[model samples]
Target: MRRLSETEVRAAVRGGVSRDGEISRPLENDATAIKCFGCGQMEYRAREVCRCGYYLRGQLEAERQRNADDYLSRERNRFNQLRKRRNISLVAFILALFLGGLYVTGNLTMIGDTLARYAFLVSVVFVFGSLKIIRELERQMVELSKRLN
Candidate 1:
């Protein structure tokens, strides 16, 4: 279920593959060794990464699945947090709107213009919360990449 490089795969096809290939013995090799998605650590050969660790697509895949799971978990957490914040902000925004509406419909004191200001504030708060979640997810991505290195 792993993706492998053409060479390693060719080796496996040619029966030139190592016994490790049969037993699914993950080579100490990195991303260059096999196509296992579960691979980590960049592979290198003769001072170059070309033939390095096999870039285990198998292991990398597994790791990615795990990372994806973790990411989902984190996303759930962030979603909850943002939902709570948004609920509170939305309530405040609604209250602001109500007041603005009352002023507009009623007489002067002309606070109608304040409605735009309140709306701007609410939007900013929501945007900031969303960006925070995005930033967190990106950080997770970077850490996952390191596992394969």
Candidate 2:
């Protein structure tokens, strides 16, 4: 594409069309028939006042902004989800510790034979499951932080 001088851009914007009065066939039916003074190409949209290269540059900038917004939104959502999961895991770990303490302190004997036997096993399951989840979330959080830099 040809390089448009500052004066040409200003003229195209101010004058509303090229000095040659060349009306593009596709844009002739539209209200304003302003072509890009720089490249001499008609506006892509009916309301567009500038030439093709400038319009395309504006479009590219908009696309880049949209992509950046999308990336930030995705990262925020992922971080929120990870935080929620970590909180749940932490709660589970605390409950498991409490239960295990009760079993170790012989408090399970008060609950009787059948229930006492399963308390330790359930506590063990909770501890391991919470640890696994916490480890995985920590790894993901690290990875996510790395991407931000």
> Clash pairs of candidate 2?
36-51
* Candidate 2 per-residue lDDT over residues 65-93, each given as its tens digit: 99999998899799889989999999999
What is the clash count for each candidate, in the order shown?
36, 1
Off by over 4 Å in 2: 1-54
Query: Superposing all C-alpha atoms, what RMSD in Å does each candidate have to the true structure?
Result: 13.7, 11.7
Across 31-54, the per-residue lDDT of candidate 1 in tens digits comes to 434342234332322232223434
List per-prediction Cα lDDT, in the order shown: 0.52, 0.73
Candidate 1 is scored at a TM of 0.31
Highest lDDT scorer:
2
lDDT value, candidate 1, whole model: 0.52
Candidate 1 residue runs with Cα over 4 Å from true position: 1-65, 105-149
List the candidates' TM-scores in order: 0.31, 0.63
